[model samples]
Target: MAQTKNLEVWLRGPLPDMPPLLQPIAHALLQAREEVQSFMQDFPEELIWERPAGVASVGYHLQHLAGILDRLFTYARGEALTDEQLASLYAEGKPVEAADQVSALMQQYEQRVDRALEQLRQTDENTLTETRRVGRAQVESTVHGLLFHAAEHTMRHVGQLLVTARILREKTQA
Candidate 1:
C-alpha cells in the first residue's frame, strides 16, 4: 500500500528539526526588553525631540523598532507584504509617527511584542517548520526564524537607539 507523505514536513523542510519549546528566541526578547526598558526610561525628552547630527534621534529609532516588529508579525502569518504595500501604509522606512510620546510608543511596542509571543506559543510544531513565502525576500524561513528575527532585529535597533540617546545626552551635557 502506498502512503502519502505529510505535506507539512515537506513544506517546512527548511525549518529547524527541533521543538520550539527549546527555542531561545522568545527568552532573548524578554531579556532584551527588560534591559531596554531601563534604558528607555532614561531617554531625555529633549533628546527625543532633537535630531542627532547625520543620524536618527532617539524617538525615531524607538519608533522604527516598533514598526519593524509589526512587519515581522505580518510576515510570520504566511502573509508577507511587498515594499510597495509597506509604503502605502506609511510605515515605509519612516520612524514611528508617535516618537515624541515615549509612553504611547512603548505601550504599543509592548503590545506588539506580546502579540508575537502569543502567536509563537500557539504555533504548531509542524507549522513552525514550514517554509512560508515572504514578499520579495523569499528566504527559506520558518516560523521560528520569523520569531527569532523579530527578537534579533529588536536587539539591533535597541543598541543603535541607546547609542544615539547617549550621544544626544553627551552633546547636551557638553
Candidate 2:
C-alpha cells in the first residue's frame, strides 16, 4: 500500500548509519527496493518465470537484483569474487526445481540491502575517490562509482521487473 507518488526515499529523511555523502546512493536503492516490493505484493506465483515479449522472467530479475548487489558490494570492499560467488553468478536466471517463492526472494533482497547499508555506514567518505577494480576484467572504478552503480543498476532492473510483471499480469487477465 506504500505509494511513491509524492515522496521519494531521500524525502523520507536521512538513513541511520549512512554517511552524508552516500545518502543519495542509499536513497535511490531504498526507493527501488520499496517500489519493487510494493509492485510484487500480489504478483502471481504461476507467472514468476513467465517471460512476455521474450523478455527475462520475473524470477530472473529478482535473483539478479540480489546477486548483483552482493557482487558490487564485494568489489567495493576491494575483494575478489570467491568461488562461491562465481558459482552463484553462473546459476542466476537458470530454473531451479525448488526455486524460492516471490516472498522468499523479497526476504533475501531485504537482507542483502541491510548488508549493503551496513557496508555503506562503515565506508570512509575520504576513500570515495580511491580506485577499485571490478571482476576478472579488472575494470577500473572508484569507491563512489561502485556505490553509485549499485543504486543505478538496481533501479534499472526494478524498471525491467515492473514492466515484465505487468505484461504477465495482463496476459493472465486477458
List TM-score per model, in order. 0.72, 0.92
Q: How many clashes in each candidate? A: 2, 0
Each model's lDDT comes to: 0.66, 0.88
Best by lDDT: 2
Question: What's the TM for model 2?
Answer: 0.92
Question: For candidate 2, what's the RMSD?
Answer: 2.7
* Candidate 1: clashing pairs of residues: 12-129, 12-130
